[model samples]
Target: MREFCDSISSYVSKQLKFSNISIYQKLNVVMSNKVYDLQYKCQLDDNVLVVAVCYFTQYLQTQQINKISAALNVFSTCAVLASKYIDDDSFQSEFFSDKLQIESETLSQLEMHVCQALQYNFALEQNQLVNIQQQLDEILVNNSNTPKMSFLEE
Candidate 1:
């Protein structure tokens, strides 16, 4: 998992040249916080987080490297979509926008972009989910400095 993040960091740095390492660190912190907030506030299952990670990985695999803002938008949209996919009573875009502190219109646009990037396909095989969950577990275990949550725990 650490290797995955390191490779992504290296790729983004070499290809995008958008910002320094500190910016990526900050983005990780912010995204982590937002995912936690989404879970807590929406009472979403932790599978949402796992699925969001999968969606983000899929988005990265599909798209070219871009600016930090674009990357963040895609990530945020992934979380929103994951929640909606797993939770029938998921919150709407306005709710996500408020929780994420992003403008509603911007969030909507990003959501559309992510949906298109995904080619409207959101299915994940059981094995894929298991693999992603394992990677997420390793990431959480290795990064003890980050506040821990049992994302896959019942």
Candidate 2:
């Protein structure tokens, strides 16, 4: 995933002739260094963030869109999530404006598209599966001293 992220960042840097690589590097640093309190956020770990960015970028490339403002918005969301999860910092709206070289108006539109693409589902991920398993285990332990809660069979 690290390699993939690096590759995508590199590709974007070349294609856009914009300084997106530095933004990606900063995002990596933030994820590795910060800390957060919330658990239900949509932040990706490094691997998944990279994959998501690559997925979006590849989609844009296929469409032959010279403008990357939209892709950067999606990338910002993924990067912010990664940073929040790994580093524990909330993603500021300013980060989108400053890092991706996008203006406020364009960022707003991109944000809307990103939300639509994600179906407003911000808490679904592999890590959530772990959390769900933990909750289920706690339920089992709490029920151990009582009659079991059984699933009905057909």
Candidate 3:
């Protein structure tokens, strides 16, 4: 594991520094930090992470979720989808359940929600990814939450 780079690292750490952001923004930082941990433990590829983030962001646009449970459900579900869609050796639900403490059935349902939200559209373009990153950067910069660099330090 490597560092998040100075710019992204500063922005991410700042997410935890402020206390005047919405719950959505707080969960975004949580999801971001959790994904970093999952990537290290699950040995996920950059492509899988890209797809996961895309799925998470798109699902949020269509759903009216407002709980940590729902947030983690979507976050972990997106990771499950991305790994299966993009990786040859995909992970199992039990792995996520064990790591994230979400039920396997719930993750399955959340997976269905995201897939249906996009009609099973898992493909992502470079421009779309760039746009997503920029959007997250802008939003996260304005948000506040503490993120630990447990996986890797810069």
Task: Tell me the whole-model lDDT of each prediction, alpha carbons only.
Answer: 0.67, 0.43, 0.61
How do the residues 1-154 of candidate 1 rate in per-residue lDDT, one tens digit apiece?
2333332233323333446777767655555555556566645556776787778777777787556666656766888999888878888888888877889998888888899988988998888777766655556556455444445566
Q: Which sequence of candidate numbers ranks them by lDDT, best first? A: 1, 3, 2
User: What is the RMSD of candidate 2?
Assistant: 14.0
Which candidate number would show the highest lDDT if scored against the true structure? 1
- Estimate candidate 3's RMSD in Å: 6.8
Candidate 3 lDDT by residue in tens digits, 38-126: 67766775556656767776776676565655665666687788888877667677887777777788777777878898788888887
Clashes by residue pair, model 3: 15-145, 16-145, 16-146
- Report the C-alpha lDDT of model 2 over 22-126, residue by residue, as the tens digit: 755554443222211011133334344433443344434434433344344556654554344445464665664555556767766765665565554445455
Runs in model 1 deviating more than 4 A are 1-20, 145-154
Evaluated at residue 68, the lDDT of candidate 1 is 62
- Global local distance difference test of model 2: 0.43
Clashes of each: 0, 5, 3
Per-candidate TM-score against the hidden true structure:
0.74, 0.39, 0.66
Q: List CA RMSD, all candidates.
A: 5.2, 14.0, 6.8
Error of 2 at 128 (Å): 10
